[model samples]
Target: MNKALPVILICLLLFQCDSGKDGLPANSQLLRNTDISLSPDSFSPWVPVTNDGFSLGISQETFLSGNRSLFIENQDSLNVNAALWRQTYDGPMPSEGRRLTLRAHLKGENIELKSTGSNIYISVRMFPVEDSEGTTINRFLSSQNRFRIFGTFDWEPLAVSIPSFPKDVEFITVYLVMGPRTTGKVFFDDITLTVE
Candidate 1:
């Protein structure tokens, strides 16, 4: 009976350790409330823009090798625009109590003069998909588009704080929008999200 008691106690201890409720375990590091980092070689899975005339491409001359690559497109016509690519996953995010910080490193070159305006902004959005329209209720959590120049390759890092959202958030989307009324080229790379 004494030996059996010792074995049972050990089993109970192991069970508690294996249950990850205390905090994140070694293998669970990636399962946090932050967006994955984007390197030159690694990109967050992006949903292609299906809007009329918008397109996406890969740029090599402008990215940091092995861990950085640029997503580029031409918003030359009034109807065409550029957007952040999106991807869907079944993984879990951090619980709703924590605040999320989004970060990105980007550079723009050959931006035409006519593209200057508040419409040319970079934004991050979170949306919940519903059964009715096949479209999600989009919440524009944050954005940045105020620039002083065009045609210069400016390397910039942007960070935005996202408040705790409702539990219904089904998808998070990031975008680089050229005002639907303007025309030019846009480039982006290196995005990160952290929980605080």
Candidate 2:
């Protein structure tokens, strides 16, 4: 084998790992503002889900890139099962890939889960259209415990890939979840989605 083969392979690996540094790939043509970088006048595409004691918004205190990151926090005053920031896909359905992947960079402090089922993770809800009317949706997430943060931690990357999306896919809902009455502060940046 050529001496340069190893170096080229390493470069390919690094590029995949740092794909979020500049922005989503050219093929990621489905959603807008996957990263919390844009200052959307109305924040229309990304909806803030304020439920129970959890609240979400953009934060500048810490970010993986750009000037701000999406932030979520659970208030101690209330006990809730879950809260999340959600974005429903509005673009054309992806018809090429058999699987979809979602990823984001996150940092957190004191992420305490009240129940065994509680988890802090990202979820992708898929709506595949079998008829012109609509279709039932299914949700997918990264392995729960592997990426769950219960204590303070530095910036980390988490990813999930789910297979078997039909060619006639309708839409997808992406979620940044703090669940089962999870308490703590988490900031997310460079959230991205891709079909593969």
Which is the leading candidate under lDDT?
2
Positional deviation of residue 126's Cα in model 2 after best superposition, in angstroms = 1.1
Over the stretch 50-163, how does candidate 1's per-residue lDDT look in tens digits?
455555655656654343344545555565344545444335554554565556666665655453342445555665533245543334555544444345466677666666
Span of 10 residues, lowest total lDDT, candidate 1: 24-33
The lDDT of model 2 is: 0.71
Candidate 1: C-alpha lDDT: 0.51
Which stretches of model 1 miss by more than 4 angstroms? 1-44, 50-55, 65-68, 75-77, 80-83, 112-118, 129-139, 144-151
lDDT of each: 0.51, 0.71
lDDT of 2 by residue, 1-196 (tens): 6999999999999998775443323355455776666764544477877776677878867888877788889857247557778888857555533467788888988877777777788878766534344533334445466665677888898888766554444577888878766788888888877766
How big is the positional error of residue 142 in model 1, measured in Å on the Cα after superposition? 2.8
Q: TM-score for every candidate vs. truth?
A: 0.59, 0.74
lDDT of 1 at 7: 97
